[model samples]
Target: MRDLQADLAICEAATPGPIQMKPCACGRCNQFLLSITHADGRFDPENAKFIVEAREGWPEAIQRALKAEAEVVTLTNQLYNCGKAVFERDQARQERDNAEDKVDRLEDELRMLQDALNQRYQP
Candidate 1:
């Protein structure tokens, strides 16, 4: 895919007024900000039906924007994983606590039965 810089250059070269009014390839009106060549032999900028100023800033600006977007996506993924881990840990802890409580109750019942037997047989 063409880097943002190449795409921006195409936008800058196109006629500003017509390009602004023209519909993008996606059928959306002027939604395409830039275009660049792709590896699949697609995204041809030569036959672009629109016109815009070909500025030198196109590449740099697009690169920065892409980097920022990647960072945001990474951060979102990290937060989701962290939340899942915390939930799992809490569930495990609760299960352990419940098992301990059951064992304590069972032990108390056994001790009470032994004491009653001893008192009855003492005579």
Candidate 2:
């Protein structure tokens, strides 16, 4: 919400020039502006997608908002990946510990059996 308002403010600050007609990626003939609005602009997450008309300053604002949104999404993905890695590491450590304990128990049983056989043969 804050980001939307900030981008709008940037658009409002720019001169209200003519809207430039351009080809949008959505295969539409769209008008673009590079303008900013005031600090007290109305808020909407989808504000970047909707231009009030073909104003000069609005295009730049929209671009900034889109870029910021992308960055936020990337950071969120990184955070989730980091958490998953930590969980995997912990699971691996627990498995290794369990295996080591089993090896120790088996070695102890083998030693006891060997001692009993030696005592019987020597006597």
TM-score of each: 0.51, 0.52
The TM-score of candidate 1 is 0.51
Candidate 2 differs from the real structure by a C-alpha RMSD in angstroms, to one decimal, of 11.4
Q: Estimate the Cα RMSD of every predicted model relative to the unseen true structure.
A: 12.0, 11.4
lDDT values for all models: 0.63, 0.64
Candidate 1 residue runs with Cα over 4 Å from true position: 1-54
Best by lDDT: 2
Q: What lDDT score goes with residue 99 in model 1?
A: 93
Error of 1 at 92 (Å): 1.1
Which model scores highest in TM-score? 2
